[model samples]
Target: MSDEAAGRRPSIRDVARLADVSHQTVSRVINNHPSIRPETRERVLQVMSDLQYRPNRAARALVTSRSQTIGILSSSSTQYGPASSIAAIEAAARERGYWVSTANIEPRDPSSIAAGLAHLMAQSVEGLVVIAPQMRVFRALAAQPLDIPYVTLQSTELDPTHALSVDQMAGARLATRHLIELGHRHIYHLAGPQDWIEAEGRMRGFLEEMSASDIPTTAPILGDWTAEFGYYAGRELLRVRDFTAVFSSNDQMALGLIHAIRDEGLDVPGDISIVGFDDIPESAHFWPPLTTVRQDFAELGRRCVDVLLGPVGDSAPVPATIVPELLVRSSTSAPRPL
Candidate 1:
């Protein structure tokens, strides 16, 4: 049962011997030391692979005085954006041989955020990827200083140094402008919850575009970013009948809005055009196919890992900000004849 009785376990020395390098060089490669040359690093890693030389986490921690683990603080893992980003972060971290731990904090209370951080600390994570997109989350994080490095997956405007998020404002503008170009002067916005940073950016973009076009803005209908809420909002908007198009904050709400419109004997893109954000996989299969903005959560997640794991003095020069694109479909058209 002992390692020596079973042909002995490979150590850093074995890797160094096979790669024709010193044990210190092997250590540098394992720790991602910046001074190691690219060619030498590759050769050392190849020998490690050939020998199946897996570093022991316990010994490495004692030797390097750090955990090789990264923690993720996420808000809602059920939502598409947050869930996708979390998955991508895990994948990216695994590719670099770092373990990932996630703590989901739904409560907006400061104590909840603290509890989440405590959970990750118990695991001795070296760095953190924060996927809390609410305004209160940022306030909670800024309330105290952290010893370990942390990166945020929120609005770029929040933390210019470590933000990794898609341009929500630009995406919202693209959605709204699509309706405007189709000759829909009276447009309505179904915004998400007020606490969300993405919702704020999107609402700002919608208002900016509307004001720039000289069109008087109607009060936005705030929803909970659910298809059910969208349905209710759509049914209520029927009484007003003033707006020709509606841009929901996300695809779930947009689908619900379409259902409500159909139930009221109204046709999409004929009586009312609708646009949504976060082009979820099912958007294309919707009744008339959904026109929405597509954000690259995977790329955003990869960038988060790159910034957190890169060398201290040579961190990513620019914060990651993904640009969203408009995907046109059958869900939008010019206003019908009055």
Candidate 2:
């Protein structure tokens, strides 16, 4: 072997010298930059192959001050929607050769949210994706303004440039409208907790749809997005059979509601029709199959990464919005003949 071949590991300059190219051109090729001429790139790559050269990530990051890492701040990571979205975000980031740092905020308090943010910041993330669902989370995020570009997965009038949303409101409206069209004049809404952004959107949609149809809107029962809550709400509802149908904010609650109604010797669609949101995997297998609205969590996650890496790098923010679709099933039907 030649003395040069026997020398220490090859560097960018070594590859550049052998390929008769500038070190900058070599760097561009290493980074897969688009501007390098095809022939030049191929020659540089061949030289690199001959030298067994590998670009040093640490050196590049030190020079760029970019970890090539993104942070994810998720408040409801355990839930199906947020969990699925986070997975998709990770997958998308992987495809782009980016690292993901995740922080799960379990508490709604200001301290917890701040701590979560601080944790991600410590990782030296170049950008952030916030999957915060609660209104309080938005408040907490605002309290500590972030220096790095970030994207929020919520729909609100505030900070439109940094927000991406799935039309939770429209999904709710579709669910309620389905019941209305089925000739059910009286309907109840099972809403998510008061402070959750998604819950608020779903509730607002239900109200708007009910008002538009000239149907009297019964007060919605606030649920904790659990089947237990649904079961309890169902039991209590047995005392007063005021509505012909119920629209739940999520499938989990709908599951509980179904159990409760069945325990009370009531037949779904036969006595009280039902609808739900977030058509989780189990929704299709629910006792009678749940009619629900589906949100493309995967698509939403992909968009979050795209927007963050795009205009965000240019210091220009672009918001992304996706709509939801309603799925009809056996859970809903026209009210029994009066």
lDDT of each: 0.88, 0.87
List ranges where model 1 is wrong by over 4 Å.
1-60, 311-319
**Full-model lDDT, candidate 2:** 0.87
The positional error of residue 4 in candidate 2, measured at the CA in angstroms, is 28
**Tens digit of lDDT per residue, candidate 1, span 226-257?**
99999999999998788899999999999999
Q: Weakest 10 consecutive residues, lDDT, candidate 2?
A: 310-319
Assess every candidate by TM-score: 0.81, 0.81
Q: How many backbone clashes does candidate 2 have?
A: 0
Residues 36-152 of candidate 2: C-alpha lDDT, one tens digit per residue: 999999999999999888878667766567778899998899888888889989988887779788998865578888999999887678889988888778876777989998988
